[model samples]
Target: MRRLDPRPCVVAVAVLAAIAALTGCAPDAQPGPGPAASETVASPTDAATPSSPTPTPSPTEPALDPDGSAEDNLPLFTEVVEKVWKTDDRVKGRAYIDALVRAGFDKASMEVTKDRSSVGIPADSIQFSVRWTDACLVGQVGPSTKKPAAVVLPHLPTGGCLVGETRPIDW
Candidate 1:
């Protein structure tokens, strides 16, 4: 495969570790002026209104490395995936795949499961991945998944990351 330019951004090799830290862990730098905190509370007796912390103007995140191994990119990868999980489109595989593309990952290196099963039923969950050299940057999400998950796993013996057949990223 042709090498994509390495961009600084952001993995978990352990599946469980991926979902453990999903919320409010987005890149410290966000576009425009937006609330940095997801929620705020104030003491009823306090005279001052609650204020959210100002987000850093620059990315406090590790840069994503296209030329690096999955482990080297997990931090920014987790952050990007988590950011997508916090959105309304959290359950859609396309959202995560698209977000990764926008974050500088090569779309050609990615794979994702179908949104629905062959029998026309919505899948319990979906898995997506990017083959990064010897490791795979993988992620899962859906109603059944309960939360977005990610990991870096060694390529399967069959030379792919996921075990089952995956959908095409034709779009």
Candidate 2:
């Protein structure tokens, strides 16, 4: 038989007493019985199973052709550019204009010029000139007199996505 040390026994009892005291002092430490067991109820053997299946919607009718004019689709281009601009300035600006021009606006016939000037002791100014596509309508944005600091001619709105009058402003 091995004999236990008194000091070890004393330490063990002290630690246990401390633990018990702590557990007792805890706010919600009562060791109560858990919730009662759930009651078992009888179920119908031949109950019809519930079903939920969404009906597929009928396909939407296709839009009619607007006389094959690019001008008719101007609103679409404006909406696309607006949405693109919300998240991407670079994409909404020069990149969008380039895409429109490349996609057939290169032959725009109307010539529009924009001139910007900052009035102050030390002056700052710029100018730009652009051409409108014959296939659609006017398409230009920039300085009017000399070369502009930058120019971007994004697609304009016609009468589909949104209705608004767009005008160039000098600032």
Candidate 3:
């Protein structure tokens, strides 16, 4: 009686199991609701049954725009801009800002400038100035030696902002 080589068989079974898992056909696979099933709702009770409070909107959903005013949107814009300026130097993950600018927020613009006593990544101390307009932005950034560093963001028709003036701008 010859002993069978178990290694190749074991490897083949492992590969098959991995493939099944990746294809989502494992024994543990469970069915999820279809679109029609998801749309189904339970019947509402009469007025005698108190209604449950409405749930808060999810982050993925846009907030209700009361009166649909541009100024109302400004707070959301300012909050995002300030957060990006204070935390990010490279300005990563600012897709929403780009969208806002591209959306022709000619009435929405921002300027940011940084000032520090010493030149370094983590400066000795820093200060920043900002100004925003409907069509343009002016601001400065720096260690404030002879001149402070500045950045200007201009509105774009294609829906994005531009940065300009590495040297301190007149504002």
Answer with 1 or 3, whichever has the higher TM-score. Answer: 1
Model 2 C-alpha lDDT per residue in residues 1-171, reported as the tens digit of each score: 998679988999999999999998887567866556785544574344335655889975333233544445455445433343344332223444444444444323222222222333212222112333324333322223132122234444552211233223211
CA lDDT, every model vs. true structure: 0.83, 0.39, 0.41
TM-score of 3: 0.25
- Give stretches of model 2 more than 4 Å off: 1-67, 90-93, 101-171
lDDT of 3 by residue, 1-171 (tens): 999999999999999999988888555456775458558555466554557876877775233243444444445444444544564442322332343344344323332223322353443223222223333333222233233223344455743344432223332
Error of 1 at 150 (Å): 0.9
Residue 20 CA error for candidate 1 (Å)?
Answer: 48
In TM-score terms, which candidate is top?
Answer: 1
> Residue-wise lDDT of candidate 1 within 4-66, one digit each (tens)?
654432232454456656644666665576555985645585536336655659857677886
C-alpha root-mean-square deviation, each candidate? 24.0, 19.1, 18.5
- Sort by lDDT, top down from the best: 1, 3, 2
- Cα error, residue 62 of model 2, in Å, equals 11
